[model samples]
Target: MLKSSLNIKVDRRDAKLVMAHFYVAFIALLVGGLAGLLQVLVRSGKFELPAGIGYYQILTVHGVVLGLVLTTFFIMGFQLAAVSKTAGTFTNKQRTIGWIGFWIMTIGTVAAAVMILLNEASVLYTFYAPLQAHFVFYLGLTLVVVGSWAVGTTIILKYAEWRRANPGQPSPLLTFMALVNTMMWTVATIGVAATVLIQLLPWSLGLVETVNVGVSRTLFWYFGHPLVYFWLLPAYMAWYVMIPKIIGGKIFSDSLARMSFILFLLFSIPVGFHHQLLEPGIDPAWKFLQVVLTFLVVIPSLMTAFSLFATFESYGRSQGATGLFGWLKKLPWKDARFTVPFIGMLAFIPAGAGGIVNASHQMNQVVHNTVWVTGHFHLTVATAVVLTFFGVSFWLVPHLTGRKLTKKMNKLALIQGYLWAIGMTFMSGAMHAAGLLGAPRRSSFSEYGGAAQAAEWIPYQIAQAVGGSILFIAIILMLYIFVNLAFFAPKGEEEFPVGEAANQTEKAPMVFENWKLWLGITVLLILFAYTIPFIDLIKNAPPGAQGYKLW
Candidate 1:
């Protein structure tokens, strides 16, 4: 099985499709990273825009380009490659669908990006109502979401084909994981689609005089929180399925991994109210119920952590390592692919802790609307998820390009990861500290008419600026490494690692393949958590506010 898996390469046509996504993702990194650096500089009170550009405009660029564009493109490309390698290369029809999806997404991204650059859509990445953007901006984002659905269709069709061919046997682990994430994403995107098509679009086009802020926000958060999980599950796939193979170890248990993913899908969507804990109009009972559901997500996260510890310890012991802490030393610290993503794993510890604090109503009150929330997501998405994607690129780009990751490139990759860690420690750490001291998020530098409290945050802002500069340097290094791997590395095959289970005799239960059961449960949970709150939002909502182009 291992030999056969290794021998099955992604088809040449499929590689072109994957690389198209990578090219766009890397370009976004450069643009977004520069914008981030500028943001920090301005907030530090040491710089000004040269061309009458608004600070929020660049902030929108930083958030939308990195948060939405880079993540979605890279994930779609990676999942496509994983499915092709594991399930079998795509049929010509499937590949054509993928290309079509790719072009639509690219066109949409270009439209949205141009609007932002023209200062027409300065509503930030959230695009919250009342602070409206151009009609094209809304249309562009809608197209992006629709395009992703099209891309996800290809993955679904391919998985169905695999199941049809295999009959009774479990689908490939990577392919199964891709399918779960794709389905979850499809379900989650419906909220955003509804908000754009039904609410924001009409309002922005002047067809509607008023828009309900509560319903719009409620719908956005419904899509927003799970959007975090959407970015995360792909990284989890690397952790559970690919990391073991990279480290010369076996997956701890196939059933445990699948069950954990199932748990994430079940718990992730029904818990968006946690983001609106500070908002009014929602009954406390509903908020509390959603908070409980949110806490349920921690169960699968812990399961993943436990499984990883077991995988590492088991692998270490097999190599004759001893002592409670000795297994740590046995890890492949020298390998960039292992070390980079391991750093991401470490970042998630604090990120998860911060998330718990944010979800708790009482604790959230203390940090609500503060830079601490900004710091929390930076650690979660930027450090944990983005770093893991970079780690994947170190090998993935080479594999798709028919090249090997050279020694020089690997060393540079290590430097890039560590630089990122150091930079984030400074930036996110300072943001958290200043937030505790009452620094507001989503605001530009200001003395606030000589307010005493604002003075306290300036030093931290300087530290953030320093850190952002460092992160930009790391981004440049990463881009260089990407270029080398794609065009300059030695021509050879690079393994696309897919680990086997530690116990071959134990098969994953056939019930896991029952998507009807899983999807039904997922829908039920979402409705149970959302239906009443949504109705309340619409039924008792205040007279809607007219759109404002604040920028």
Candidate 2:
């Protein structure tokens, strides 16, 4: 069985390396969560910063650590473990390369964190040029990105070697998805690499007198929107490949899952222009093109939803559940792993709908730069992505450490997931409502006692603060669960929930495995989508703007 294959023992070196990434990632969550709690309270007019600990400063910490640091490290660690376990042992050389990458990223993270803590780099995580951070901050982030490339390179090389060794056999599901995710990341990071190395770092260091703000933003969005997918695809991997088997069901269609990943790779990058729809000088035609592509990207998610529900129905029928909706009850709600991702997926339904609103040019004008955008992404990256990470860690940490997660602890983790969902309902719901009343995002305070329009935002801000408090408590509970699983549980091995289609004979087509072809299509789409817009941005660009230390 696939589950037994997943339990195959890995060398301690690879396990330790993966665990190291998890440790740093969790520490980021802790620090970032604390900052989040402070941000909400301050915005509510309920708390004031101690002098020198500024809001933007803490916001930068929250974004960089939670968004960039935690995601990068955790994905690298998760993919490495996936490839190794699913394919075979990582050669000693591969482990060395991975460790080298990990250390470089760690050094970069430390450098950036120190700069932020010292209040020298308060430009915020978007690091929109024109508002510059210390040169080292850019350099450190560049290194973090480069380090990820190193780790991604390891995955690619290992997959190639795997293909050669296995000859005609299909790559294992987890390994296949991990490799695809790596390829997509490598493709996406090119935009950011060009932005940082060519533009921001030079501007920050004063090597360039100015950098074109429009061009810089164009480059950033090229990477930025796809970065959302980078955060998401791993969680999607869990939903598609792992969840069904965990809950005693089979993957509805392996080929459908493979197609979705391929679709994402092809459509995800080209569509990032949707983020820039409201920005000036860019052609409306180009924005419309991206809008169309954005809608195309939604198809795969619909496929996934259908596939998952079919899996549930099939399982429920087997369990003697009668009619419509009965299947939902038959799901493994008692299992923390299943319950956590299930809730995360449910959150994505509305989150995806909000994204559609943002992508539509006319609708976007209504909520652009408002707190509604903040509300949308919280349901996505914060709840869907972060909660999924927490769920995977419940088993992953124990699996890596060769320990058991106690049943009581499992119950607590499930509770933690519910708490997160409840908190997000309060926070994101209020943000959406207030944003409709014209509340802005990225502002330290929205409540101005004299402005009645601003006064409309006060109650919502307070609700956000309360919700954030609950979220903080949930994060603490997650950390406690993770630590206990890692260090205190009894020695045992955990099985991976690797599902198969109900129809055993339904093999994926050969095209699904054609990486070179898919990679080619991915490149072509990027060129088609970005080349003209980027050219326009650079050619008509107003004289580049000088850096302002605007924190």
Candidate 3:
């Protein structure tokens, strides 16, 4: 079993499908990174966008391309490759479905990109109503979501087949993680889909003259919070299963990992209300309830933190390290695969703390709609999740492409990771400080008629510009490494590492595999959290707002 698992590589055909996703993802990174640089420079109050280009247009491009296009494509591709490798190769039908999904998503991405470039759609990633886009943008995003469903269908089908073949065993850990994320995404997206199809699309198309802004936003946050976790669980998969193998250590506990994932599935969805603590239309009681549920998610997060420390310490002790902190010295700091994601882990400490503050109703008021909120997610998604994705790419990209990650490239990858950390420290740290001093988020560079408070934000904005410049350099470096790994590297096999548990004899509970129970509870929790609040939003909504082409 060990030998077979170790030797498993994504099949050649599946590799093409997965690589297709990465290609689009990297292209998005280039476009979005440029947009991000422009955004910071504009906000610095020291630069102007030539040709009368609006700052918000570039902001929209940065947010949508990176937050939606890059993350979704990369995640779908990674999950597909993982399932194919661990659960046996996809059947011909499954692979075909995967290809079909890929095309639909690519087509959708192109359509949306065209609209954004044309400035017909600048609603940003959240696409909030009252600030409408061209209908084509909505349709394009719809197709992206629909395409992901098709890809997710393949994962589900593959998992079903694995269970049928194995009878009583737990599914592969990576495959199971993929399934959890897919299911959570599927459930979560219904909110966005509903808002788009029922509210935004019609309003944009002029079939509806007005949209209930409250309900639209409510539905959005329903999808929004879990979207964070959707980006995260794949990183967790790497942490729980892949990192151990990378570091030559055993998984601390397979059961612990699965249980944590199950908890995430249960708790991550019903907590979207925490994002709307300040919004009217929802009862404060409902918001409070959701906030409590949001805090529950911290349990699993802490569980993961505990499990990782144990994994590291146990591995360190195994190597004859004795001091309480000796494990820190024992880790493979030179190996980019381990070091890059580890930096992400360190970032999460602050990220999680910020999340707690954001979820607290009173505390949220202090930073609500402020750049601090923006700074918080930068750490979570941009640092923690993205760095892990990059780490995964250092190996997974080459593994799929039938190449080795050359030693020179590995060293470069480390530099890329460290550069990202430094750049984010300057950018996000300044954003947080500026936010506390009354800076607004999602705004163009403005002196506010030379207001004193606004004057205070300029220096931090300049710091952000400096940081953005450094981050853009790192992005270029990453893209270069990706190209080498995909094409120019020497032809060789790269191990697709999947770690064994330290206690292999201990079987994961069958309960952990009971999806019916888990999904049922997930639905119950979401319904309990949102049903009344949603009804209140619809029934008590104010006069609807007409669409505005703000740009």
Candidate 4:
């Protein structure tokens, strides 16, 4: 007897509710992409979108809006689905709160973007410096983060509600991932939130005369870099659990997916200073510790990448796409189902490779504060992360609206993914070379004047510009598809499927829980960070050793 294929027809109302976040996320991407193009234009020394204010403000806006806001909003959608699926739980009340959170965060984010465009907060997304923003920018950012926390709270409580209702069985994989990531978010956001809410707000408001720059920067990344993981984990979840189901395969290892999510939750915090590799820190020991553990953080990511590839490879070979790497070509590339997602991970690997190199102590010095830094993270956060949101949206709209995506737009979306990966890789490569040849990021015009690649870099910048243009247009095509599904496409009265109808349900009985494993490992790393530095501080004490700045 042969196994039959499942034709998943998910809940119409539920599907649309889930898909709405993607449209908003795409809109945010469009806004950010415009800012990115402008920043590149100004960087290329060809055109300044606006005089005087220049690149700083535009880059700042682009970075925060696209990098943080868009990604977070989209992930919240995953969280929503998880809550509903696990315990058969969905609440109009909590879902209402979720929508409110989106609007609040979006408004706050847009307000911050406007401030950046007005040249009020050129402090960049890191917003560190002798430079500061208008209090409003900081306030806007705070509200955005707060609103996001609202979504997180809704997710966590909803998961709990599901668990209570379900009693003994494991929650769905999607719910499990969401619960764990939100828990991580709660832990990770605290330090930065405390610094911002308690210190930066008062100081920026002029209620306080001064605050410690060193301490604030320390606290910020303590909350910040883990922030990157919060955004990336959803993409990882999609890669692991969601994509497998979409591609008609069970997760290679359901237990392994749980472990990966758990690892992300536990270790994603406490590994902050890889971003601050060049900046002054609590101690060399601290920086060194983060550098080492950054490699550890890479493990779960690598695991997911490999597992996803292997699972897909198995499916492809089963379908007769045989031998070595030949299975890669047999994947169902035309179904927005497959193609939209495949390259997001494809782009992620090189971006992560750049990240690992950039995080190393020695290489960090070479690229710190340079365009290479910009390009590398652009590939990771903006390209790979955001593309996941877009890809998932494309995969989902048909189910939601009950219409098929036209083959024309499907091809366009696939082409868009290719353009994004190819364009960003070469663009980032040029940026890395320019950085090696010595070019500072965040500067409008080249202080280098006339270096060799400085001239050649023009074409790469043009490539990025063209890539962004295509990406922007691809996003429009996505919107059109979703709209057609929602309104124009004939409504299907056919009953939707339930149970295993979702992107992923939980694996049975995970003992590794991977969180415990990650925590054990991370504690050792943190011990390495704090113990030696504190011991040194004690031994080197003059009068007030606690007052020592180890830089």
Candidate 5:
């Protein structure tokens, strides 16, 4: 199904372009991490900043940089590497287009970061309507998104070119995964594009007097949940295509792998309304429909878990391991590249469980707008996705730089992953506990002058602050690892791992490659799920809400 070697090499020009993307992503991680620490400190009532530095301003920076900027840049860089490694060399035209996309996104990030830092756009990453930002902020973010579209377009074009040249052959699994994600992202961004370009930008620029908050939120979530899948699929790509080879095993099932990726394309988009289960204006019937769709999306994740463990178990048995859990001990525990993603998988167990909780209609009411939701996403995006990115960076940076990954740097990376997992346990666990006691999320300060309900949250807040400090330290270590490898390590070429299917003669079913069918189904689901609800939102909307500069 997949070949172990594709005669791929990371050429100098491609390496530089990919590194450009990663460099920007790391800078975001550093700045965003600092802001996260500040948030924890201030919200815990354990520290105060200068009068001019507001908490919400810092929070906005944290969310936007980490959530939007870091993920986009990292995923772009990763996909480029994946496609380049698996498919073939990129043409000069494709490389040029990629760089153009990178610059556009960087410029937009700078513009938006400037606005957030100046406190002109403290609306947070969601940037829900009626809490309007400056027109520049909206325009800047729109460019960021549009820029990603350009990147995705280039990748798809590359894939299309490959398919044309090599008719009837299965695409490399890594390339296939990249193409699927690019397609998913192209669809996902439609809603956000509408939110920013049609609605928010016009409203913020005063081209419109007011905007409907309900409609804006719905549009945002339309992009938002699928945005989560966008973050996750790259990690899954690494898991399915890279992790098995890293741990001395082959992919468990090429057919199952393709099936999961296809399912994501089919089910990931229409389920955004599950995020709006607690919001108003959308009918309950529509919300229920989304909830069901959201659960349907879970099928791929469960399949993924099964395929991965099967790969590990096969490897473990090959090494003479006995009994059920004994295979875990036989697996690589010291390798940074493998352990980081493995930890991410472990974290996902809890995170996915919490997601199930969030999607439940009755359960959502209990935790809506609370720190519980915040904790759940942290375990997911921050821990599972971000940590996996960090893990991959261990070898990726060194590989592209023509440097050897030193033993010391590998150890540092493993330690960083451990620290992150430990700190999150304290932070996220406390957050979930406090949320059940009625603690709010997104509040700069929850003290409420010692109100009894707020008093109950103090200890958990303090735990969060402590956990945050440790996590910040972990980020610092991660930065050191990347910088040292990129600049200071001994020169050596490292191979990009591309695993073969366990049975090399077996091919993925042709249906998995029929992308047009999958995409059409995706669009139909989105329309069926959202079309009437969106019309109702706009037609029955209350008086439009005016912008408020709350900070």
Candidate 6:
């Protein structure tokens, strides 16, 4: 099935945009990773200095730059590329606008990055009400979002245009998912953007005496929940649609992939209030509603995991992988997508299985702001997003650079993947255990606490630092591998093979296109969520939010 060449045309300009997005995201992640490293060092008493205002400012810059800007922008560009090919669509004009959005967003990013480096705003990147800031941060984020909003429009218009010309055909499910994600971003992000523009700016300039804190967190998380999905969908797209194709198996259920995306669009936004479980003032009942919906959110994630694992099993059995677990031995461990995500998913199993326990009503009191929560996010985000990014990087690198990856380079990258998974497990495990023993999360340092708490964290902190170093070393090796692949490696002169998956394009089943089942599923979910914020006498709630307004 591996053909050396195929007729598919890769839009080189589009490919450049893809590279540009990652270059920014990866570098930003590196900066954020360093800030995280410092927090770890400070906690361990390994170093101390007048990090002072610079420390807090860097923390804000780190979160905004990496968690928001980098993740959003990169996924935006990648989705555009993936949708174009599968949908048999192209966007020459919109692609140009998309790149322009990239530049505008970039300028805003640089301006914001510089301002924070100078310690002008220490707002901690949260839109916490009454915590005002200088106008520059707000303005920079405005310009950035405006440009991205434009990019999103370009994507939607192109998809619509294609659908019109194609007559009565349904769009490729991914193209539909991309546009849904775009619409979600447009609708959801406006909540925060509105706060920054109308509310925060005017208030910071003393135009208003106060804004609503309860209102702010609610609107903010409405934006925040789907934002996680925005970062995540690109990874999930690869997982469901592309990975199976890449691995030489029919997707276990193309319908399931589409269903999952639809479920995400409906459910992801409402669940952000789960993070507000510990915060005062928000209605406890409303938070409980969100918590129930949040648990429902895990259902689709589980669906995707099973679908992918089943595909893995099929691929393995075909390769003569024997017995129940024997398929594990047969995976192309050298393939980045298969190997990295496989291990990352394995890492997630323990952490996520633990999360179900942690998310339970009573258990939340046990580990709410402790290292357990930290460990869970690491497993989900790192395993899901970052590992998938590595997988896609392998798929795209050679095509982008016009060189063959040396076998040695591929093996090196695979080795780095294993090292990453192993190191993350050990470090996160120690943190989770420490969380149970009363270690707090998000502290700049563990200094002010009592001996019992300090004693619990001492060993884990050291282990975490060691894990960080291992991860750093692995990243350094990847930089070397990419350098060789992009510049130093010999040009094959033989036309590069089309993506390994394109040749298997037999007609896919339309199992996902069925609407009635999804309609029923969505209705039931809405009922469950509606019940969340309601106060039945049978339901217990804490003060200030017990009598929540359901509508």
Model 4 alpha-carbon miss at residue 458, Å: 4.6
The local distance difference test score of model 1 is: 0.90
Per-residue lDDT of model 2, residues 1-551, tens digit only: 12233436555778898999999999999999999999999989879898769999998999899989999999999888888787777888888888889999999999999999999899887888777889898889989988898888888878888778766666777888898889889888888889899988887787778777877887888888889999999998888878888988889988888889889888889887788888887898999998999899899989988998888899999999987888788888899999998899999999999999999999999999999999998999999999889888988888899987779989999999999999999999988998888898888773464677887898999999989999999999999998899899899987756677787887778687897799999899889987898888777776434322322
Q: What is the lDDT of residue 78 in candidate 4?
A: 61
In candidate 4, stretches whose alpha carbon ends up further than 4 angstroms from where it belongs are: 1-20, 51-53, 401-403, 446-507, 510-551
Q: Tell me model 3's lDDT, rounded to 2 decimals.
A: 0.90
lDDT of 1 at 170: 82
Task: Give the alpha carbon lDDT tens digit for every residue of 106-125 in model 4.
Answer: 77877777788788888877
- Assess each prediction's global lDDT (C-alpha) against the native: 0.90, 0.86, 0.90, 0.67, 0.89, 0.67
Root-mean-square deviation of candidate 6: 5.4
Off by over 4 Å in 1: 1-7, 447-449, 544-551
For residues 1-551, what per-residue lDDT tens digits would candidate 1 score against the true structure? 32233235788888999999999999999999999999999889888887988899999999999999999999999999999988888889999989888888889899999999999999998988778889899888988888898889999999898887778888888988999999889999999999999988898888987777787888898899989999999999999988999988999999999999888888899888999998898999999999999999999999999998899999899888899978888899988999999999999999999999999999999999999999998999999999999999998998999999988899999999999999999999999998898888888875342678888888999999999999999999999999999999999999888899999998889899999999999999999998998888877776535322322
| For model 4, the run of ten residues with the poorest summed lDDT | 494-503
Listed per candidate, the RMSD to the true structure in angstroms reads 2.0, 2.3, 2.0, 5.0, 2.1, 5.4
Q: How close is candidate 3 to the true structure, as a TM-score?
A: 0.97
Candidate 3: segments with Cα more than 4 A from true spot: 1-7, 447-449, 544-551
Error of 4 at 164 (Å): 1.7
Error of 1 at 176 (Å): 0.7
Greater TM-score among 2 and 6 belongs to 2
TM-score of model number 2 = 0.97
Ranking 1 against 2 by TM-score, winner: 1
lDDT of prediction 2: 0.86
TM-score of each: 0.97, 0.97, 0.97, 0.85, 0.97, 0.86
Off by over 4 Å in 5: 1-5, 544-551
* Residue 72, candidate 5: C-alpha displacement in angstroms: 0.4
